[model samples]
Target: MSATVSPIREPLIEGGKSYHDITVDLVRSTEKAPTRLWWIAFLISVHVLLFGVFCILWTIWHGIGTWDLNRTIGWGWDITNFVWWIGIGHAGTLISAILLLFRQKWRTGVNRAAEAMTIFAVMCAGLFPVIHMGRVWMAFFIFPYPNTRGSLWPNFNSPLLWDVFAISTYLTVSLLFWYSGLVPDFATIRDRATGLRKRIYNFLSFGWTGSAKHWQRFEALSLVLAGLATPLVLSVHTIVSFDFATSVIPGWHTTIFPPYFVAGAVFSGFAMVLTLMLITRKVLKLEQYITIGHIESMNKIILVTGTIVGVAYLTELFISWYSGYIYEQFAFFNRALGPYYWSYFGMMFCNVVSPQLFWSRKIRRSLWWTFLMSIFINIGMWFERFVIIATTLARDYLPSSWSYYVPTWVEIGIFIGTLGLFFTLYLLFTRVAPVVAVAEVKAILKSAGDQYLAPNTEHHEEIMKQYKDAEDKGKVYGSDHAHSESH
Candidate 1:
């Protein structure tokens, strides 16, 4: 396709980075010593992770009795954190798979980090269900593998059991999708690296060469994995919603949970992506690649999904009242006016009220504002889960069993620990791989890059087009330029 005139678009890539400069700029952080800021962030995250690990061990030794899970509230912080992390992880595959399939060039700026976030977030999320099991060692029972005792089989009918398959499959496919995109980038580092680092990256990259055949297979495999991952994005969260929606509890059993949860997942997921991205772009000196345009684009998603979530929230309430189900009515009423009213309001303010700021383009484009709001949205998402679980579970069918639920210090620690663990992994990831997709940024640089950086001259555009044309024909371009550049 040829570039045509349009209303002038902001350059997705700033600073006129050539294909070579993209490699250098993206890989520079990995090759150098950790900055003071990097160490400070890493250490803080590590300490938080350690605190979380201690809490996990304490929970394991003492059992969930350490948690404040009462008779009425069997699922509290653990389940809430589980859902929150899972929702947070959704942006990765959404960026990598869904955006890739749609051919959105903007995804190049953030998809690599988002995909990594999905993997790490899922790791943090998977912890909750296992630990919440009370007996941590028997966590494997959720797996559908054949048991030694023939009669004692995993419950196929259980939604919790469905989570095992759905999440595992999602993780596996996401891992593949994430790693596949990293191969050429890894190879880039390998070529640029020294003895030991070169050897390591060479192994990681599986000896990738800038051959026509290699790029051909890489693109093909990416599509296949994206095709596999796209459905998992929708299905994994829908199955997660079943954990609540399939329940008999008044507010819990509803047809709305599937779409509600999916929208909420994408909402929170995009918010999280923005939060991490804002920080990442700053710390890594990647402003040229992860530009303000990327920020505005993602915020648009947050606006759309946040609006969907707001409607879902209203729908849940309307359905309860309009259905004339006394139990459902009381469930939502308790959430608003009952003991947990504080959390309910927080949820509404953060998820619904706050994201509405993005209706103003200036607000969406502002870094400080977007970062601040991202934090707000995530906190609100946690509140939303809490309201859903606590309000519904705390007051049940039997009045005598009704009680207020509060998380123990242990629950809060584990949740914070997961936060720490997530950041710790992400901080470490910056050292090991290019946070931005190096190959992909190059792929779209001509078309989507800044106005000045675009091939305004015939010579430059032709140089860029040779690579694009070969890529389209599934053959590598010539060695007239750098091998990695053409690759």
Candidate 2:
């Protein structure tokens, strides 16, 4: 194609050519075959899932009695699992909604997988409360709906009831937020699909045509949802913390629980994001899309949140001592040097001290180190919950009632099973859902400009042409030395 050599209105490149004459090819390239590693991950996750089923069957036959639950410590691994999974869901909204509001470009790389993590984590979380209910069928009694035989109503003031509301709201809103972004990408698949795939994509696309008007409305709706979700994410965890803080137990009754829990939620959530992104970027061959910048940004958040959580831990101990409450003081002492002291220290070392290493750029950028760190962070976060719930409840008021709680085989089974369930769903989502937001990526690649665009790039030439014409007219006719400034 013929090209202009000079235009006073456009900024000149090193060669003194105006507008840089950038060109971009719009046609996307696809991989020839699914990566071998993805198949390996899928198979491994399935094997773990089968082990989970065996555990569930054993639990069903053995009954709740198989798990240790004394009067003083009614909640144990089940509650910890619930909180851990819910906390894991937190980062998805933060990455998607909070970062989106800030217009952070790096989010495009991680948001899809993070949102998928939120949905799967929530699914894993929902199981604990249901399975813990024993009958499981009567789990709906937590709902506020009226019963025919009795004038029964769930206590709105209770945090558990609030959980029903908060969890439901978070899951509903996150699903909508995720699907809203997926629509245009789904349309891309719809256009590319054949046979039965076409019908499935067609229904999911909702007649999307990728018109500018559709994008305009879609962007507006996304922003609105993000606004709604930002507070919703914070509130969900705050309410969850209240489930502990509102209690009369000495360790659980602290005022700092809300913010502490929020920090931990975000900390664990970001860890989960890191875990998934590290694997996905390689599995999907998306290293160019999900650059090192994105991982570093996530690591920074993890580091900050880790420090906050560490501070919360120290502050709680300080307040417990300063308050001069014997029970509160004992709770802190027990957590640090009690029977489960190893667990407490493990949580501290993993959640608090370890993330400090992420401050080093080399640690953040190293794939093997990042992967190990993410796993440690998750383990640390899980132990944080376990220590909080188990340690606190295991040694409450009245020495007569104080008894150490232990998780039986069934309890262990269910806990392990949840991990299986989480990865199983995540593995399936990788295959079925768009692993990355293709449409959003295209928009980003377009805006980021010629740095990523390559030769035979005909589609963007029209854009360059219009841009040049607009720039040319805006300049005043002048000598070769003349330059036009952008308003």
Top lDDT hit: 1
Model 2 steric clash pairs: none
- List, residue by residue over 1-487, the lDDT tens digit for candidate 1: 4365233456789887778999999999899999998999999999999999999999999988989788898899999999999999998889999998998888999999999999999999999999999888888777766678774888789998999999999888898888888998999999998899999999999888879988898899998888888888999999999998998999999999999999999999999999999988998889999999999999999999999999999999999999998999999999999999999999999999999999999999999999999999999999999999887899998999999888889999999999999999999999999999999999887777665434454455686788788866767645444666766
lDDT of every model, 2 decimals? 0.91, 0.80
lDDT, candidate 2, equals: 0.80
lDDT of 2 by residue, 1-487 (tens): 2332222211111121122111111112221244577678767877777776786676566666667797888889988999999999999999899999998766876788899899889988988877877776678888878798496888888998898899999999999999989877777767777888778988988889989888899999999999999999999999999998998889999899999999999999998888888887776656656667678888999999999999999999999999999999999999999989999999999999999999899998888888899999999999999999998887877888888987887778777777878888887777666676776665555333233233324445766777678667774344223553332
> Using alpha carbons, what is the TM-score of model 2?
0.85
Best candidate according to TM-score: 1
